[model samples]
Target: QLDDDLVSALKGALSGSLEALILGLMKSTAQYDASELKASMKGLGTDEETLIEIVCSRNNEELAEIKRVYRDMFKKDLEKDVAGDTSGNFAKLLLALVQTRRDEPSNVVDYEKIDEDARALYEAGVKRKGTDVVTWIEIMSQRSVPHLQKVFERYKSYSPYDMKESIRKEVKGDLEKSFLTLVECFENRQLYFASRLNEAMKSKGAKEKVVTRIIVSRCEVDLIKIRTEFKKHFKRSLYQTITEHTKGDYQKALLSLCGGDD
Candidate 1:
């Protein structure tokens, strides 16, 4: 076990991106997520991207734990914080996610319901003059991932645009981004993380916080898959990308956490 005093000492000794990475790595996953949520909502403005990514991507059990940890650590309700920080349809979608109401992944896929949902999504967005944000939120939030996958697949037949394109046409701003993130996560979560990592590294200087959060958060879960997807999609390994984008202890730490090349 990592000693709390020792961790505090290390935190005191270290600074900058390296310290952030190291400290983030040391927290329990739920604790890390809770802290990230708090940080996103801190101070002048909310980091809505972080809020969307964390809230929309996590499964029910994980979100439940994160919400609990958020209250315990910050003495603030995660739902209230989210609701307070956001408004309109975006807030509604995020609050729904925070409720942790998503159905679990299961082998059993209901094709009948899946088709119905696909049609519903089509009518709500592509088929209608105005977007039905309520239907979009309900289906996206409450349905199982497997069910959603099939629904998105079936949705292609009903509408000229796929689910993502439909979202783009239907909404704008944070809501659009959040829905897109949710769909991407449902489609291929590892690929979603890989894309996030790539986006972080695409510019001249790395977005170190985003890089650290995804690498550290998903390290134990699905990083190997993320590495493979990164290589396949971006034509460069995550290991190499990190090497090119970062240096010193921060680089070394990320490389080690990356495990190895694809």
Candidate 2:
């Protein structure tokens, strides 16, 4: 009771700006993610990659918090902004993700449902004349991770090809990439981050922004796993990649977060 009273008194005493900073310091990961997303989209040219990374990486609960914090910080609906800034299937995918309506995780894996969903995807893509993008979007957006994992596994046996190959054969352009990234994240989030880091570092001139975003955002989450995946996939340490690609305080900071190369 006394602690609550003292906190209230401090809140009353402190300036709004100071209080806001203090609050920000105490904000949750979802809130921080929301703020980062808002900043990425606020400028003249949108940071589309950042927007996609954030939206695709977060789960339904985290996305709900992001939506709330985004509205509080920007005074604009995130969905509307995303719609306005992006177009076509990419926009659709982002909007679907922002809905935060995916199924809750379940301990029991429903094989029947997985087989059905896998067949749905197969019919929508490889088995059809044209891709049934809506079916893909709906399933990808709504299904739980465990459910999707089963779906992908079932897809391999149900069809002659892997899910990624099916996607590759069916769609082209940013939409295809978006769906593939979603699948990758669902399968293994740490590997997805590792892949993004590799892409950022490998790109010409190097995407410093992407590198910074991944390292900063993931440092507290599964960065250790990401580092291991990086080494496994790339055969080079993420720390070494950062060291070779970046210089000065920037390199030092990234290496510090990486906690040395494996």
Candidate 3:
């Protein structure tokens, strides 16, 4: 940590240039996410799905930073805002996710535990008449990614269909969508992004916001893999798809981030 003298000196230096100070503050990814989250909640209709997706997908470290950033930027608690805006089981799930308490990814995998969870999932959803959403939520939310990977792999053997297809058949509404997204992302984030990009492009009028968000968010992380997945799954390059679907400065900016295809 900086000493008080250095801190004061740095603050004084930054205070002299308003533009520089603003730019420096805007450079933080956590702050950017916090700002976006706040904006999503500000409108006449809340972007509830986006809020849930972001909170659920982010791991403990990222969510902790997000909470700090949210407080710094909004002078309000993220959890409280979420609670005020949402209700019922969905709200509870989002609240649980924002706690940032997912089990850390584990290298060691227990085959028996995986089998048990897989069986539990099958019994909770498909094997019975009514679905056990609480069981599904608890299992999906609490498990490590590695463990979930194994659980999904083992689930196929226990069930007639793949996990995604099973989820499609067994679950419905927002919970279903969230679980499917989580399963897809845990299996392959790049492919999930490619699918999102494809959906954005294929829809009527195009989903520019989704496309921009994915490209900007993943450009530094795995845009190359996303491009590859786009090609592999869709039989067309992400660049070509973006070129066809978007126009003007937005298209150019997204293309620059997309770079080249596989």
Give the range where candidate 2 is weakest over 10 consecutive residues by summed lDDT.
16-25
lDDT at 25, model 1: 85
Task: Name the candidate that leads on TM-score.
Answer: 1
| Residue-level lDDT tens digits of model 1 in 100-210 | 888888887788899999999999999999999999999999999889989999999999999999999989999999999999999998999999999998877899989
* TM-score, prediction 3: 0.83
| Root-mean-square deviation per candidate | 1.6, 6.5, 6.6
Q: After superposition, how far is residue 73 of candidate 1 from its true place, in Å?
A: 1.4
lDDT of 3 by residue, 1-262 (tens): 3454664565666542232233333335676567667877885778866675567666677789999989987899999988887776677677777877678887777888899999998888888998787877778878888899899988888889788888899877766677788888789878988998899888997776667656655666678988998999999999999889877656666677688655
- Prediction 1 TM-score vs. true: 0.95
TM-score of each: 0.95, 0.84, 0.83
State the lDDT at 169 in candidate 1. Answer: 90
What would the TM-score be for candidate 2 when compared with the true structure? 0.84
Clash pairs, model 2 backbone: none
lDDT of each: 0.91, 0.81, 0.76
Give the alpha carbon lDDT tens digit for every residue of 1-262 in model 2: 8755765776787643334333333445666687777777776887766787888888887788788888887788889988988888888888999997799989998888998999999998888899888899999999999899989999987778898888888888767777788889999888999999998888887787677667766777779999999999999999899888777655766788788779
